[model samples]
Target chain A: MEENEMRRVDLVVIGGSAGSFTVLLEILPKIRTDIDFAIVVVLHRKNNFTTSIADVFDQKCALPVLECEDKDRIEKGKIYFAPADYHLLIEKDSCFSLDYSEKVNFSRPAIDITFKNAADVYQSKLVGILLSGANADGAEGLAYIKQKSGTTIVQDPESAEIATMPNEALKLCKPDFIANVGEIADLINQF
Target chain B: MRIYTLVDDDDLETLLNDVANKYGYDFTEYSKASMKRRVNRLCTLDKFASFAELRYRVLNNDSYFARFVEEVTVNVTEMFRDQHFYKTLRDEIIPQLGVHSHIKIWLAGCSTGEEAYSLSILLHEANLAHKAIIYATDINPRVLETARNGIYPIHLIRGYSQNYINSGGITDFSDYYTANYDYARFVDKLREHMIFATHNLVSDSSFNEFQLILCRNVLIYFDKNLQDKVFNLFDASLENLGYLALGSKETIKFSHLERRYQQIGKEKIWRKMK
Candidate 1:
């Protein structure tokens, strides 16, 4: 709930499902307040509306928080959350898309779709971070990022709030770094 | 010599993959069965004694892969292939389309430009050609260049003419083109409002939204998973209430997002639901 300063992330993709909020809280305070890039957080949700995620994320992070919009431009130093009921896609030109037209992995805002598209456009510049979740949605997407020459990080399964998602990702593509909450944020600030 | 005999599915896949990587023409992600049949046929027709022999010949012959791709996924479309769909477009959609000064239509997977030229001809008949923009796209560059040429075997003209008559031709079909020995040259004006480019409907996202989208015949070859992926892309690239037409055998039913569309009927027309 404290104010530090504005920081930019060139592009950060965070994936989680079962217990991601705790992970977010641990990492938010450690990111440098001076960086300038966009951060996209894809957290799984039921078909119901996502009313409180912005409010919750806003309290723990220094950056302004809001759900992404279709055709919305990604600007630096803003924390954009994937709105429920849509899979967020990054265009070739680095704009965002809210595609509710289909569901992948039985979840809208499916992690794989966003990660793959983001990797395609950003390539080696992409940083895909997978956190704790109950499902396998982020596995293929993380693999896509590594295959496309992007950097990857995942929450260490031993210390995760829920280890299923990060563990699934390890089976698919071994990430460049696996760390606990304290170290995860420490590394993100390095970027 | 009887080469290509040990060419099982895996062998066929590897050979095709090698061909694609060496020649820069990708068939790796295409329908497995279709690719299999084509590789088998190409080897048989070219007369190789074994898979090794076939791979050797293919590695040395980049042109063979070029023609192989052309033969496997070639549009094989003639003018007005579906008369009833054309009739529905004219009688139903056009009347309700209102008088827009310019119309933009995307013909996704528009192999060799048959459907693009057909639509152009229809717009010309309706006095809408000068205001129409038809962006026809295919993944194969060779096919795109062929489409740019706008020439077809004169023999195919007879069938196209028949399809034209079946679809309610108002004027003689020959009015659209001139017979030049073995090939027919379509009127240059038909190509004026048209742009043919290489686009992969499967791997590429929809770049621009259009008032109408015609992607027929091609989806039948894709698996259900890929089909659903592409249908979603089409949904994004169509304007609100924009028309989406699929092939006769194709439907939005059972897809992950079928409820977003309103089907026109057995006519193969669909509209984005607001």
Candidate 2:
């Protein structure tokens, strides 16, 4: 794809598992708050009733961070994290829908579920990034994003804390970029 | 790449319309994303070669349509879910309701009766079981049947026990049920004050006035229009000062009834002021 032919990206969905938390901690503070698109992060985690991961992210992140609520309208320049124990889907009307349906890939808030749903809504104007993890959850989702003509990125497996996730994604689809955390952050900053 | 085509939005609309006309079960206003996911799952589970084949079977076969309704509705629930919410009820709400001579609690969308049984245990522990009547209702008759049976898988008992203890349970959790070969059948005494029935929040009217109404995690499946309708139903069904509880992620903040109800504590419960 030529640089000039790039479509304006409206949504960026990032999916990660096992070792993704530290990677996000490093990448989020570096992201500029003035970006036009919304960012949704879906991470595999246990349901903790006492505290929220979004509240933690909000403290370190430049942009406003929120735990995605049912029927929340998607907004630009904001960051949202999928709530635990639910599958978060992007609606065609630009709202978030939470489902308590059965877990996919042995996990709720499955990366592939969100990625596929977002791809259906955002189509070519989306960006999907799959980061460090120990499972195969995000591979199909990253591939679906590529199939939808959206940009796809995978953390270089060698640079990942756990190579299984990125390596699985690599087997499924040829992402537009494969980079380390620093390079991934740099590419997002460019957007 | 195992890319399976889901039911298209238009196809979903067509099928929902047909179901509504044929069976009076309307799902047209449900969140499309989840609905599509469930329908796609049903197709695969039932071994349908195409969406057309699935549609034909659902429209023509009565038993198949029954299975469709059972599979489509979300039934993922457990005992003492979000233990803190139950803790709030155990510590704060139930104590307040205990002052009343009779307590009427409506557990809307009570799938398989786990929550109903949990509440019954709370009431029994509080010594209010004799005066408390729990009306547990769900849209699906099949699940209502399960709720009436009050039997659940034994494997889940451990988790339920933990949640019960966390929720300030006073008695032994094992005292409530007897372990059978594979399932734990709750004591018949727990069913004495409980009533299980089919009640559709979408198409049915409010059946009774209640001091407390719990429709947790159920509204997340609805769109804004349907949500407002159900909220109004809950509002009408609730007595003045009656409490309404929603799922953790759901709220009445932006709804028309927001001003009339006040959030009680940090939990998802709301009390009607007037």
Candidate 3:
């Protein structure tokens, strides 16, 4: 693979837990609404919280955001959020599957499970981003995407409200890029 | 615009049909994407060199095919899962159902009997246990046997207990189960009111009519067509105005039978108003 060659992508998957809402608020609304790739976000929250996070994201982002349902078709230029209490997975057909299988990383919508499945489906034609979180959930998943030759990015730890997630991913994958909130917004907009 | 095919969909479809013809167990209506993933996983787990070898083993060996059936079905469930549904069952559905002198509830795809046992606990608390007869059925006989035993790992009980408390449980969660070593055995009294049976949602017809039916998380594995077939089966089995509970993520909104049912308290629990 050439160093300067741009990787073609059909989807962008971003994972965060704990302190990620603020980072998303900063980055999502700024991304160019016309970008071609689909975006999926997995954020961990309390089990009892009934508020729709996708509705919140929809308010802040230029792109339409939705809570993923089982067997939902994945389309270009849309954003999908893992519904609470379900593990959002991507199938070979490129549709979504919400699994009630036991929690991984003590989270139902675990980042690892989603990222690994995304890597299997997208291979090199995907971009995985790990943002601010308190747990080590997304580290191994980000590494998986990197091993599959997909682009991987970690929020520069200094900019992450909680640095554990980004730092752990950085340690595991030594990802393709490290950028803060604003630069990540720019990087994604370029696609 | 190109889709990768590690195993071609048509070949897998043929393999599934062979298993059905040989064993009388059907897999035709299941969602292909997830089913393909599950089949691929079975191949890797059993170290089968190819799908053709898997097909041969499934045709020639009965025990191997049984193992294949277990691997393909999804058995993810917990006692009082989706606390809100259980809470609604206690606060609204059960109270209205109390008017009936004898109640029959069918729990379709009742994997491992957690949901069945959860319902029994609710009935016992509501003082309706004597009148309630719950039928807990699943496609996997192995899980139905475990469901009949009513024993769960002690570690998992803590989570169930928390869910129980969250669902407005009035008694101590430990009162329902006796813990010994690493396993918790639910009381025999709760088990007495329930009957566990083996019924495949894909191939089997409804065995009886019921006042309440629960088919949670099971239909998500099926394709849209299969889901509608199961929905028709549920509509046929459910007594008019009977309660139906689905998994939190499962929906009847897109099914042909959607107009026949009315959403109850939560979107997941519905009533067959028509």
Candidate 4:
């Protein structure tokens, strides 16, 4: 894809597991509040009766943060975290849908499910970022984003807290950029 | 390898229309994202080769259509899911309902009877089992059969036990069921006040008025219009001051019935005011 022909990005999906919390804590606080696209974060988590990840992110992030609910309409300049124990999907009309179907790759909020769904909805206007994790959940989805001519970024495995996730993603498809957490934050600000 | 797309949007529309027109099971109002995923998964699981093949099998074969309905509507559920919600029911809701001479509770979308059994245990513990009658309903009859059996995998018992404890349950959770081989069959006494049946929230009318209605994690699969229709059905069926519960992420706040119901505490349970 040529730089001159790049489509206007409308959605950014970030997938991580294992040691990705520190990365998100560092990156979320740095995200500008005025970005034009909506952001969704998909992280592997246990089903807890209390204390959602969104509540924690809302305190530190510049933009409004929320846990994604069923049929929630996507909005610009906000961040949504996929709720635990359910696969979060993007409908064609840009609303969110939650599913309790069997987990993929031993995960409910599987990065690949959200990534592929978002890719189908946003097509060339999507950006998918895979960060530090111990599993291969996000690799195929990132690769799918690349196949759809959307922007793909993998955290530099050497700099990641755990390299397995990013390394697996790198093995699947060539991402547009491979950078550390700080560099990834900088790239997102430019979007 | 590219993730295959055997079923596209147009294909899904045609399939849903055919099923509704021929079979009267309308899935046109289901959330398309989940529906599409389930349909694609069915294709992969059944090895249909193509979307047209799957459509032909569904449209022509009654047994295959039954399988299709089972696959498309999600039935995954657990006992005492979201411990706090059950805790609220145990500490607050049950005590309030116990004051009534008899309790009628409707468990809509009660898949596999986990929740129905859980409610039975709560009522039994509160000494209200004799006065309570649970109407458990689902769109799929196969799951209703499972619910009626009161048998579940033994491995799930550990989690259910833990959730029961977390939900303020004090009695021996193990006493509720007897483990045989890989399955745990719940005591017959727990199944006494329960009635399991096939009830489609989409097209079915309410059969009885109730003091409490619990339909959790089911509405997420529906679109706004269908949700409103179901809510109206609930509104019509609920008695005055009866409680209506939804999934934790779901709400009645934005709907037309918002003004008629008041949310109790932070839980998704609401009380009808008018």
Candidate 5:
């Protein structure tokens, strides 16, 4: 085998909305805490609601889960969730940049914004995963990630709580992997 | 297949220094991550091949420099954002400030002056409008001008009205503004008690003392050291036992000033005890 066939993963961005939280609960238990990549999560939330997804996920996941704050440094082995009403963007320096611009696809913490920014910052070392949602927010972003040569994954639309988001992502670009919640965890761990 | 080479962190730092040196605005203390993302965005949007080219344009062009500043600062604000915060301000903080014969309130980093206008409305409800003068300041001159205009897209007014009702607004929210064709202009009376000014929090020193200061969400963009510096500034600028309100996510728990302030209620409002 050629030496560089396996590229190191720097960041794993999981974008979803609606029913993605249930999928997260399914995957978080299986994700190896020792994995060498940072995981940033972007799930849509109501405009002014308080966010507690990190705390909710913390109960099931071994790794620390946090609601991202502006300027929070990205570190491997920890999970970060996009705060409500802010678009979570990845900086070139590998940290979080929160913005309050107008909502996209009717979601403030738009999955597309996070995925596109992560693609720009992490480039080929990134892995973008699109999961269940009611809207098509992450579709263009997943395509952008694929264009940057990053690995892109989509949850099998049949297994999605809401197929619209995953189906839209598949329509926009051919992801490198298509798996259900359990298989997606194994695919991530294989990295 | 194209390779995307990320901008080097050191080179970005150098470019920031160049901008500061030429523009006379210090951005060094701002969080590196957000700054890098914004600069990279500007690079793509402006079609600059490199940060070096960006530095040259920013140094030579005045209008581009203004655009650069706008891109760097965060401008996402809404009327009566964090509705409960406004509710608490009306129920608790305003009553406390009423004890003073005249109130001077400072809204730091008042982007587009939504918070400032929101405060003006609350003051009107509390019968404190006549006695209160709000100094709404931001670093971006463009946003300050927008704040002065007090005009917003009519489409957004519905959500703002809901926020107003949520914040215990007693009167018809529509009474505050006149909606025409595509925009809603806030009543001129609401603009009277407010003064919009350009104030740079990073490099500028405090010039006036206030009975209450609200610096919400703005500090989250700053580094820990810079946050401490601003907290010190707030501490100095606030009158004895004056109130301070931070964004919901922000806290003074770890700051040096934490012990000096006491949390008032469920709200982010705090009273300086010492």
Candidate 6:
């Protein structure tokens, strides 16, 4: 962490695939609630079928959790999932627009979509977190967040269950924090 | 609560949900204007005076819902509808696509088959169709059926012919289809490499990887966030240095994926980073 740089954010967006569910179970538990920001998880939903991932995550965390719908308002302290097959895009107003469209990178609930949109909408005000994914989905998008001067974090490749995505991101862009999943969550709570 | 006439937005949503549950189709994430127009057309056919009335009817009537689903969700596309995009492909793009030994192209939201057929021709023209696999999908099952049929209203072909010419047609566009009284059944040969199926962009995960994906005209109806989301999906589905094609009016200016692609022309053709 940079001692000199300290600023609050409105929301957080995490992009992951393949091995993401367990990562959530590990990292979200240690986070503090004093920070005012919603956390959205954009994960790969292999089939279009909907699941209660947010609810499942809710059982593991202190914050509220729910699946996002079209035109959903983004509020602080809540955790939103990129509902089953929709791409979770962040509006300029910092709200959400869950869209039905062609799958990107072969995934509808794509990590890159949420990361990139959040980066564009929130810019320096946002924090983009990347974790385990099979493919290099979040690599360029993490680069984009850094380009916009937003904080970017990638789970340490060695700590990740599937490291292709995080490793590729590390290779392509220099993230602000490249840490173990537990450390990433600890930093979030402290931040 | 007594069922009364519903408002436009509410009625449309209700009807869409009804169609989804009964027919396994979902259009909840489609653009409002296009959905409105399509729903209006369906309502008119059902003799409903208002969106609410139409929606009410949809909830109770399976046959009308079937007809409504057919009317509202059809994409009404044909081969080479936008010649300029194809022209860009033939002239500036395809020549540069030789880096990958095998090519995969996905025609996302390929409503009613014209665009897929057009891509088939483009692939054949480029000598890549033989090796390339084209996956064409739509959320609407009826439309997917129509698309799989590879047939179109013959009246629309005259315009398609013009687009073909503008899109760098090297031969007669008519040579691609057999004209029935009112429909044109496209050539069977074009379907050889195509995998036409029902796939929803909003509610489906990607099933394959591709080198080039043409999802033009599909994202313009969505709001900004949705656009970025779909753009990300393209990033996931594509291989490194893959190409993504968006509609004429759409751009990646405000999207997070903007840096992932450089605009080749009117379309937003993207590449996955190496």
Q: Report per-candidate DockQ.
A: 0.01, 0.75, 0.31, 0.76, 0.32, 0.01
lDDT of 6 at B250: 49
Error of 1 at B143 (Å): 2.1
Q: List the residue pairs that clash in candidate 3.
A: none
Q: How well is each residue in B60-133 modelled by candidate 3, as lDDT tens digits?
A: 98888789888888787899987778898999998888999999999999988898899999999999999999
Q: All candidates' TM-scores?
A: 0.55, 0.98, 0.88, 0.98, 0.86, 0.54
Tens digits of per-residue lDDT for model 5, B191-247: 999999999998889989999999988886777779899999999999998999988
Query: In candidate 4, how many Å is residue B156 off?
Result: 0.8
Residue A55 shift from truth in candidate 1, angstroms:
59
Question: What is the clash count for each candidate, in the order shown?
Answer: 11, 0, 0, 0, 0, 13
Quote model 2's TM-score.
0.98
Q: Model 6, A66-127: lDDT tens per residue? A: 87755556888888888765666665555565545446678877676677667756778788
Q: Candidate 1 on A90-175: residue-level lDDT in tens?
A: 65556564443235788777898778767767778788999988889988889888887788888999988778889889998878
Error of 4 at B272 (Å): 0.6
lDDT of 4 by residue, A81-184 (tens): 99999899998888898988788989989999999888888888999999999989999999999888889999999999999999999998999999899999
TM-score of 1: 0.55
The model with the greater TM-score, 3 or 6, is 3
- Model 1 C-alpha lDDT per residue in residues B162-268, reported as the tens digit of each score: 98888887999899998988999899999999988888775677888788999876765554557678888988888888899886546677775578778886677
True contacts kept of each: 0.00, 0.68, 0.32, 0.75, 0.27, 0.00
The digit string of per-residue lDDT tens for model 5 on A1-191 reads 12256578999999989999889989977889898988888887665556477888888889999988766679999988888877787666676756666577888888887887788778899999999999999998899899988989999999998999999988888888889999999888877
Root-mean-square deviation of each candidate, in angstroms?
16.5, 1.2, 3.7, 1.3, 3.5, 18.8
Lowest summed-lDDT stretch of 10 residues in model 1 chain B? B1-10
Q: Which candidate number maximizes lDDT?
A: 4
Q: lDDT per model, in order? A: 0.75, 0.91, 0.86, 0.93, 0.86, 0.73
Task: State, as a TM-score between 0 and 1, how close model 6 is to the true structure.
Answer: 0.54
Q: How do the candidates rank by TM-score, highest first?
A: 2, 4, 3, 5, 1, 6
